[model samples]
Target: MGSTSARTETCKSTSEREIAALFDRWNQSLQTGDPRKVVANYADRSVLLPTVSNTPRLDAAQKLDYFQHFLENKPFGRIDSRTIEIGCTSAVDAGLYTFTFARTGAVVKARYTYTYKWDGSQWLITSHHSSAMPEK
Candidate 1:
């Protein structure tokens, strides 16, 4: 860890917990509908495979714009991350994501995956891809 943590708490041995905390912030900020804070979690040239639109969003700025556009169609929903798998300095966060529309009262649920890389201290989102659940 590079010791540049102000908002993130880090323990000596388990860095995964620290990294997961950072990811939780990402989820909270997104729930707040603050695209800027969501973008802040991404690296400069991160990639987002937003399956909602079936396109890839490259770069933090573009991803922010994507979030804004994407959020418009599907309102806000509760997001939860239940499981994470890590190896060395890289980790993948996977769990449930949902979008509840305000206009039609439709809720879309999906399993989301976020790939994170620990750059010494800070954990940055690299690739994010989400897919809707099968018709059930």
Candidate 2:
């Protein structure tokens, strides 16, 4: 995962629970096993630092490329710990999580941070950084 800085200002309209729900929705998208559905949660210009891939995906097509292969593994993630920070139009959810791959029956523990923006109508992920736990 790359380095990112979050704004210090607190959110005026968004709640912690709502931010948590956003993570939930993203997790659900992954369960669908569709790259397009997973990419839908992200903005057109979003960045994805994936857990298994070293490439940094910076656009929709690149994200789709990464997910296309990832979806084949049938990944499901569960959050173990999280910290949420909300700004007026942006928010960050950073945490530790675990993923189980149905295809291989493998479990991987990881660290992730998803940054989102409230783009008028809905919250969209602007950046998502994930990496496997170093000690693994």
Candidate 3:
């Protein structure tokens, strides 16, 4: 009788810096002012709880609709503070961010959380939740 040993494999965790940079990539997408470009960052099966919209976006089409309107203001985002957590093939970045609307000159402070998954070739956002801050 022969006994076989069980083997365990360790997954390499993504760096916090890399997770943090994902936000920058998403933000850059916003700079394009093209909803399609913005939506490209998200996975096909993803959720977007937007900062400006009451309705939640559950798919790429819904997300495209939201971003189409949101992008009209020419929004630009900057992170105020964030904490990132890395996993085997997933990561989360959550914190405060400020958005400056070029078209309207409106400044909004919001809290955001973005969860990402590595899809073999690239990282894609799986869930994104954002809401304006309660206090001024």
lDDT, candidate 3, 1-136, per-residue tens: 7998988545656788888888989999999988999999999989999999999999889999999999999999999999988888888899999999999999999999999988877899999999999998
lDDT, residue 112, candidate 3: 96
Candidate lDDT values, in order: 0.73, 0.91, 0.92
Model 1 regions more than 4 Å off: 1-20, 73-81, 101-104
lDDT of 3 at 92: 88
Q: What lDDT score is found at residue 114 in candidate 2? A: 94
TM-score result, candidate 2? 0.89
Q: lDDT, candidate 3, residue 111?
A: 98
RMSD of 1: 7.1
* Candidate 2 backbone overlaps, count: 0
TM-score for each of the candidates: 0.71, 0.89, 0.91
C-alpha lDDT (0 to 100) for residue 15 of candidate 1: 57
Q: Write the per-residue lDDT of candidate 1 for residues 49-86, one digit (tens) a residue.
A: 88576768897767888888665544665566557777
**Residues 26-91, model 2: lDDT tens digits:** 889988988999999999888999988999999999999999999898888899999999888999
Top TM-score hit: 3
**Clash pairs of candidate 3?**
none
- Location of the lowest summed lDDT over 10 successive residues in candidate 3: 6-15
State the TM-score for model 3.
0.91
